[model samples]
Target: RQHSAQTRWVVLNLTGEAKSWTLPEASGATAVLLTTESTPPTINGNALPLRPNEGVILAI
Candidate 1:
């Protein structure tokens, strides 16, 4: 999947608070957190958070 245009940086804002949320990720797709926050978020039962001014590239 080289140079595939299926990667997207999704930003999530918790308003400086910790919260639980869900996103629409493609089946069997992958996601990478690009944030530098001390506490990483969770996704689909996993700890993958996106801090302020940060993003996660989701493979769809």
Candidate 2:
């Protein structure tokens, strides 16, 4: 997966198999939909910090 963050947008990009469901969008640098119990945002295969004004980028 991959993502690019902005002031009010967080793009969740998938580099793996497609899922039956799609993730939602984030606004104002806040991502709530990506923070689930089953699937969470990670960095280098490890969990990254969810900060206030920064983005957590993931690569696959």
TM-score of each: 0.37, 0.22
- Model 1 spans with C-alpha error above 4 angstroms: 1-11, 24-38, 49-53
Candidate number with greatest lDDT: 1
Question: 41, model 2: CA deviation in Å?
Answer: 6.5
Residues 8-56, model 2: lDDT tens digits: 4346542233212333433244442232222333533555454333444
Evaluate model 2: give its TM-score.
Answer: 0.22
Question: What C-alpha lDDT do the candidate models reach, one value each?
Answer: 0.52, 0.38
Give the Cα-based TM-score of candidate 1 against the true structure. 0.37
Runs of candidate 2 exceeding 4 Å displacement: 1-10, 13-46
Candidate with top TM-score is 1
